[model samples]
Target: MVGASIANFTEIRGYIKGRAVLGKSATEIFKDVVDIYGKGWMSYRTVCRWAKKFASGRVSIENDTKTGRKVSISTKLAEARIQELLLEDARYTVRELAKLTGVSSSTVHFILKKQLKVRKITARWIPHLLTVEQKRSRVQCARKILKMAQKIEKNNFPDLVMGDETWIYFENYEPHRKISNKVWATKAAKRPCIAKRTMSVRKMLYAIFFTARGLAIQVPVPKGRGITGKFYRDVVLKKLDKYFGKIQPKSGMRHIKLLHDNAPVHKAAIVTDFLSGKHVTVLQHPPYSPDLSRCDFFLFPRLKKILAGRKYSKRPSVGSAIYQCLISIPTKDYIRAFQMWLKRLKI
Candidate 1:
């Protein structure tokens, strides 16, 4: 079969040489070849090159063996040196490693990939660079929360309300720009462009409160006002209390467990005192731990995703959009979020 294939290739080359001798154009010969053998047998450029060679009175149809030094630098010593350079600085680029090891970039790449078996990756982002003590505290807090969750009756889990505040910009790009902003276009077509803009300074701070049932209330902090302890106690907690009363008038604020982050405002005397007076059990949350917060991990992300890439002229419009997105979330998703929160505690 191999000998037959070789003879067939030689026949094709001889046909090209004959066509060239007959003064046929390269394009005409290429078309004739394509008509006989089909497209994948040979490219037009290859046919043109062979026709030119034959027209120049060349006899040999085989490829010329002209070459420079062959690359054989993927040695054990080179692999060891590459490994040492990577150990010294893992951020070294392939070209940089090649220069240092006196090997071609392709050779260095082979050693790093095939022999050393290493890959480069971006550094993972974390909420905080935690110290040893902070890490210990996180584990302890997780254990305590897990214990509390196990003790709570399944039916009464809906009483657990998680709350957090985030700044909502009126106009912002989506978190996943690569996907959200992409558009279909032909290779020859000019690439689409979007104006490069920073996040809008015009934003509103909103405090969102939710339960396993769904969103309870979203309170917008008044313009020019920071989320001070006074503001939280007077505005945010008051609205939350009103919401609870409206929902369960008969059993107002009873068996309600509030889960909020360790923000300074939440830990303030006024906020703590107000919760105690209302008989609301404030769950112990570890500092710098957004992973454990239901709103941080679930609710806010969902809200932000829906709000991203949308433009709003006024703050009221932004708030309205946010409210609509919040109410649109299904109760089942809320239940799942709480379940995930408990699962994270176990982890």
Candidate 2:
């Protein structure tokens, strides 16, 4: 139990060497030897092991994990098992994984909480109406790009016009609410047509382009009509002819691509023949795929913005106002809206 000589770092190391050869335990070594180097910061057990190794003349320091030897889960194994379970069934509930892994539910919960990092939920599909198959078809019809080489051979792509008609009835306003819920309930009981004042109006059919980095009106229905397959071919083809007929093939325009939904008007017999005769390639969107349609996604909102909160005297008056507003919305805005589709097409 003699005090060691005070010295520089080298002298301290030498003192540690002499004391360690004298064979002291970790408590003794840490109290005396650790101050030699690294500014007295070498840990207690660390000091003990280095001195003992030096005394025994062991060639290597044995670095190891021995933190009190408490039982612990193998993190690597836990991660691998978690991944395996996730792949086998992505929807596997956390509780279910706990049972399968024989791990405590709390531990499984912690793992998922820390690492799952899943996104917030979103809508899977529109309610009712179109089946899964129908939604897929509609997007394809609207967005499909064909090589205009065949069009170059004959020229119809620039003439390609995609048109869709959508409804915006005044009666179609989102169900109303009031600040005073109790007072409004009785008033809300009556049907919107009779009780809640509304004047429903129809929007004219709209047709536009989805080609060569642009979109514009081929023909817009200045006045809307009840949708049917027959009306589409007849009305759509005629309007296309009226507008695009003016463009010559040598003007660098080729092939006409027309897009519309699988509504009754689109598949009319007269419409098919009209398209074939004029060399217009009519593309039918999948039913229930309105989410992808330009009319549904782009134009209707613009029209709604035009009509939003607008009070009309009657249905006919509303229709007239809509027509005037339609003409006012610049073609470039519609073009700008369709160009947004390009962003979705990217990876």
Candidate 3:
């Protein structure tokens, strides 16, 4: 089959050379080939490329030797050096690595995959690059949470209400999301400009209190005022009281646990006093570990995806869009988020 393919390629080249000798243009020859063999046999670009080569008085029909002395970049010593350089700085691009090592980009890529066995990867965007102490703190916190969760699951799993706040930009939305309709068109057709613009200054601080069941309350913090402890207590706590009644924990279980990050407002004396006064159990969440937060991992991300490409002229509009998205989330999603939260605790 390989020999047959080679023979066919040679025949095609000879035919193209003959046509070029006859003073036929590349486009004319391409059209002729399409008429004779059909478009499926070869692409228009490939036919035109050969026609150009033949017109240049080239005699050889066979391809030039693609394999040479196996690139020196693949040598054991060179491979080892490449690996060392990559270890020193993982962010180096193929061109950068090639420049440093005096090798072609393709050769560098060959060394990376076939010899060094390493490939470039994107890092997840985290709020902070955690320090050793912070990582250790996360582990400890996870262990404690796991233990507490196991104990609670022995009877009935307590109602888990995870709360968090996020800034919602009225105009700014996720960049990669496809906002416009796509269609099949010619390569020459101008693509629609669905590119996103720079974020506008208008934004709102949106907060949510939700359980595995569904969203309980959503609060849009008034503009010009940040979430002070007093504000958090007044807005969130008041909403909490109204939802589950002044007695706390609603109707189902013995207790309700609140999960939130260690923001200053969350740890303020007023916040602590309010929780104590209301008899609400605040779950111990480690600092700077948004990965462990339900809102960070699941709720906020879903909200962002839904909000992406949507435009809002006013703060109320943004709030309304967010509310609609929150309410639209399936109960299974909320349940899954809590389940994943527990699994992450084990990790």
Model number with the top TM-score:
1
lDDT of each: 0.85, 0.56, 0.79
Query: Measured by TM-score, how close is model 1 to the native structure?
Result: 0.70
Number of clashing pairs per prediction, in order: 0, 18, 0
- Tens-place lDDT digits, model 3, residues 1-347: 99877776777778888998898988888787778766766677888888888788888887887775655534656667788887898998998988887777887887889877786779987668889998898899888778788665543343678888988887755463454447677999997665454545678887888877678889989878889899999888778767877335454223578888899999999988888777778888987777789898899878887887788988778878888999999987888788888888887
Best-first order by TM-score: 1, 3, 2
lDDT of 1 at 11: 80
- Model 2: how far residue 340 lies from native, Å: 3.8
Worst 10 residues of 1 by lDDT: 67-76
Candidate 2 lDDT over 1-347, as tens digits, reads 12232324335445556677777766776676544454454556656656777788753333444665333556446756987888887777767887788787866776676556553354475456766676565445435542333442243233444566655554334333342223334654863332454444433444443333333343444544454555566665565565554555343223566667676666778877777777666655555555546666776666666775566545566566666666677766555554553333221
How well does model 2 score by local distance difference test?
0.56
TM-score to true structure, per model: 0.70, 0.52, 0.65
- Cα TM-score of candidate 2: 0.52
Clashing pairs in 1: none
* Root-mean-square deviation (CA) per prediction: 9.0, 12.0, 10.3
